[model samples]
Each structure stands twice: as structure tokens, then as C-alpha cells.
Target chain A: MLDISVPAKVLFHLGPVPVTNAVVAAYVSTGVLVVIALLIRRSLSSEPGRLQAFMELLFEYIDNQLLQAFGDHTRARKFFPLIMTLLLFIAIANQLSVFPLIFQVLVEDKPLLRLATSDLSQTLTLGLVVVILSHIVALSMAPLKHIGNYFRIGAILAIRSPKDIGNALIEVFLGIMDLIGELSKIISISCRLFGNLFAGDVMVAVIVSLSAFTQFIVPMPFIFLGIFSGFVQALVFSLLSIQFIAGLVNTAAANKEARLNKGKQAALEQPATA
Target chain B: MTLVIRFTHFSTHMEAEAMKFLAAGLCMGLGAIGPALGEGFVAAKAMEAMGRNPSVADKMVPNMIVAMAICESTGIYSLVISLILLFVV
Candidate 1:
């Protein structure tokens, strides 16, 4: 009788594209976030108001934590917006998802804004976007070296003697494993948030449906737990993204991009041209 | 005895249904053990660190929560499997 299955409910379509409740919720939430961000930016000033002061403190705390991971404030600034957006977007989305009205006001007995992140499509999009963004940044920073991270045939080719070929082959094998690791990152990242929120949703459904009288009292504890879990999941998702991006920048695996771009540009470009 | 006959009839009638519930319960129960141990370890470490230096509890708490959530994944997976067994299976 209790169904935890979140079958995608399509409300309507935009000609070719099917628009579900989850998509609509994601759009509305993103719109809400944009407006709030605009309002905050407009109000920010040299002389801070109470709201500005608190907002600034929150930003500073987040920035410092992310910067510590990156170990370079200037470079960290690039990925910081993404971290903040995801943390706040997911936090707010999680809270909105559990709100009573969203589920109560149903089109076909399905909520208009049923937990966006609980939707596989939405979670996968976020996870893939994070992974793609890290690759973009890593490549932009060090194109040749970033490419070298995967198809590390250069190491194999660099073997001077027959004796060294074994070690070079191992390095090449390791590079292939790195490529696989990048793809698995998407599945792992997406499932982590989705599973957590989906479980909470299912649990809530079960508790409420079990009995009329005990429902009100029983669900309150779970709601509190859901709130805490939402914040924790959001934090974990963003922190992981930061750690991944920082790993690329902090490692010798990626060469110094600035030096490569200017002085060693010819040598780096020669292979491509040849 | 009449009592033994009634009990035997109940089990025979509900064998399939009982097994379904049993599997779901077992799946969730056994699956939960790993995460329970993992989270316990995390909490113990967090408590030790907090006790050693009370000043950094702010930093330690969030870190502890994040790690615990990741550790909770095993339990959540068990939850998913059990839910499937309960409802979908």
C-alpha cells in the first residue's frame, strides 16, 4: 500500500520537451534564488545594514572554508560561486520539498514542487554539471597537462630503454583508471544526495499514511531529522566538489599553467601542430 | 492439539506474504549494521576531538556531520532495497 516509487509525472510539454513537476519546481526555485541574489547584491554597501552584515559573515565563513581547501584564494574564487550556489540551492530546495502545501496542492494527486533533487534527472544534472565544470576549469588552466591526465601515452612514449617500458606501461594503466574514476564520480555524486532525500520522502509518506491519529505526532520527529539531513547533504555535496577541483589545482599532476601559456607555449603547441 | 493445528494453518496460508516481509526486514536490518558501526566510529572520534579541544567544536561538528552523512549511505542503500522489497518487489 505504501509506494516509495517516484514515477516521473508529466504535467505538460513544451512542444518537444516534456515538463514535469520536478522541472517546474527547479525553475521556480532557481528564479527565486536569482531574485534573492539580485536583491542582496543591490543592498550590499561599504556601510553594512544588519542583513548585509549577517550575509557578509556567512559568505566570509563559506569563502574561508573553501579557500582553505583550494589553498589559493585567487584560484579558489573561481569555484566558490558554484559551491555557494549548490549549497544554498539544495538547502532551500530540500526545505521547500518537505513543506506541506507543496504536496497538498496536487494537479493529478501529485505535488507541483515535489523535491527537485529527489528526481534522478535533476540530481544527475547537478552531478554532471559539477564534474564538467571541474574539467573545464582544469583544462582552461592547463590544457596540455589536463589532457595528459587521461591519455598519458606521453609517459609510455618517453621510455628510454626496454628496462623502463614496464614502469611506463603501469603509469599508462593508472591513467586509464583515472579516466574511469572521472565517469564514476557522476554516479557517486548524484546518488548520494538523491538517496538521502528520497529516503526521507518515502519515510514521511509511510508515517503519514500508517494511521490518521498517530500521523501528526509521529512525523514531527522525522521532519526535524529531514531538516538536519538536508543541510548535511547540501554541505557534503558542495564540499566534495571543492575537494575534487582543489585536487587538480594542488597536485603536480597538472603543470603550472601560467608559465606554460607564456614561455613554453611553442613547445606545448608543437605537438598539436605536428 | 487444536492450538497447534490453528498455528500450522496460519503459517501455511500466509507463507508467501510472510517471506516477503521477512526478506524486507532482513535486508534493512543487516544493511543497517555497517552504517551504524561507521557512524558510531565517527561520533566517537568527534567526541574525543571535541573533548580534547572544546574551542574547535564549531569546526568539528560540521565536519563530523558531513562524514556521518557519507557513512549513512550504506544504511540509505539498505533502506532503498528494503523499500523496494516492501512495495515494488
Candidate 2:
């Protein structure tokens, strides 16, 4: 089994630097999206056929979700393509396990494509990208203030008297805690996704292996359950990503306001001694 | 002396057999109990929710499975231990 494990290798190597499986999956995912887009483009009609109609319904459903969640149609529209791509890739990957024949035929030694979300590296990379994009949007909206968010320099500089030093120290410590919280976001998001999908795969494998008679009949229901579970996990992951990004973009103004209020309080207390 | 040696060897074999059986029973028997309870609770909740809102059962079922999978992790851990005992030991 270990010998049959697919080694997702570095595509290129320069000195000690190496590319990774997640990057390759991203490219594969994009290729799949392009193919689907082309198929839709070719088949599209004002009066839709089955494929076109189905595609339209899916597109609308995802679009409506984005609109509802973000409440900014423009930003939602911009994000929709990426979100749709994720949904499609995850859906297809999850469905791959159902076709045991395809696995036997295509996978000479290893599966042609494992569920991308099952891999920790892929999910973690995607989560990190979402978080980083959120920060980018926040910073673009208020570059100088966002940069100052980490340092709390303005709060420190507001300390006019010796007594305020203790407060400044506390603020700095809180900022460090905030930094750690951001890192935890990546771990939680990735682990939650990887754990669910990988465990489901293992469960199916065990069920099928339990007995020859049970194998033919017993595992069928669980396979159906796996499909449903896969869809939900993908949706939860996307929703959490959207929520994280939305929170980051929306919180910048509130954070700045709170900082200003604190600075004001410190300044007012400073004059009492002087 | 030969009779005494043979008796000691037989006792050791019996002890080893007893340990294997104990390991297998404990690992699988205890492991399955938690997940069975968890899955039942989840199913009950899901059925109740579906009864209340039959229209959205499609959405609810999928969400329930995701929740159930998380709950089922403990069962999987137990299964792993049982397999290790059966195959490795």
C-alpha cells in the first residue's frame, strides 16, 4: 500500500527550493474549470438545453449565495469565479470514489486524481490564500492604518506620561495574541477539511473490506452518504472562507475607531499630572 | 524436570492467547459504542428537523452527515486500534 502511494513531487527544483502538489492541483483545477467553461460557452442558448439549464441553475445558486453572504454585489461578482471553481473541483473529486472501475483502470499504481480537499497541503494553501487576500483588500482600503494594526505605534506614541507605559505594554501584548489567532485560523480551517474527507475515504475502504458478501451490498449506502458529506464539507469550507474574508475587510474601520478612542482616553488622563 | 518444563510452556501459550482475545475485544467493542450512540442521536435530530421542515430535508441531510462524520471520528480511532490488534499483534 505504501509503495502504491502517489508521491506528489516538486514540479521544479532550483537549489533547495521546490514546488509542491497544491500548486499542481491548483493548475489541474483551473484546467478543469476552463474545460467546463468552454463546454458551457459552446452549448449556451437563450432557450436552454439540459446541460445549459443545469449550469445556469448552479451558477445562479452560487451567485445568490455570494450576494447574500457578502452583501456587496460587486465584490461578490469578483469572488464568484474562484468560489465556483472551488465548488466544482470539490464536487467532482468527491464523486470520483464512486467509480471503482475508473480507479482500477486509470490508476495503474496510484489514483489518477485523489480528492484535492482530502490533502492537508491543498486545503491549507487555499485557506492561507483566502486569509491573505482578505488582508490585501483590508490594506488596500486603508494601507497605513492596517500596517499600524500590528505595531500599535500610535497607541504607544500617545503615552505622554510614565504611567501610560503599562497600558502600552498591555496593548502590545494583545497585538501579539491577535497575530497568533490569525495563524490558528489557517490550522483550524485546513485540519477540519482534511480530517473529514480523509476519514470518510478510510471508512469506505474499511466497510468494503469487511466481508465479501457485505462488500457487494453493505457499503453502497455509505458511498451515498460519502457523496452527501463531501458536498456539505465543501460548502462549509467555502462559507467559513467567505466569513473570514468578510470579517477582515469589515473590521478595519472598527479597529481603527477603537484605537482612536483608546488614544483619546490615554491623552485625557495624561494631562491630569502635567 | 521435563514434565515441569512442558507445563510452564503450556501455561505461557494460554496466557498469550488470552491477551490477544482481550485486546481485540476491548479495542473494537468499546470503540464502537460511542459512535453508535452519537450516530443515533444525530439521526434522531435530523429526522425531527426533517419532520418540522420537510421542504429543506435535502439541505439538512447533507449537513447532518458532515456533523456525524466529525462525531464518528472516535469510532474510527477505535476501529484503527482493533485492526492493529488483529493484524499486527
Docking class of 1: acceptable
* Model 2 lDDT per residue over A175-251, tens place: 77878888877776666666566656667777767777777878788888888777776776776676777777667
Q: Which candidate's TM-score is highest?
A: 1
Best by DockQ: 1
Backbone clashes in model 2, listed as residue pairs = none
Error of 1 at A256 (Å): 2.7
**Which runs in model 1 stand beyond 4 Å of their true positions?**
A34-51, A160-165, A252-254, A257-274, B1-27, B77-89
Per-residue CA lDDT of candidate 1, range A1-274, in tens? 6645555578888999999888888887788778877988998889998877877886887898778987777877877788888888998787775556676677866666677888878988999998888888777777778888898879988989999899988989999999999997887788878878888888888898988875788888888888888888988988888877788766532366456566688888889999
Q: TM for chain B in all models?
A: 0.79, 0.77
lDDT of each: 0.81, 0.71
User: How far off is residue A260 in model 2, in Å?
Assistant: 16
After superposing candidate 2 on the true structure, give the runs of residues whose Cα lies further than 4 Å from its correct spot: A1-33, A105-108, A159-170, A253-274, B1-89
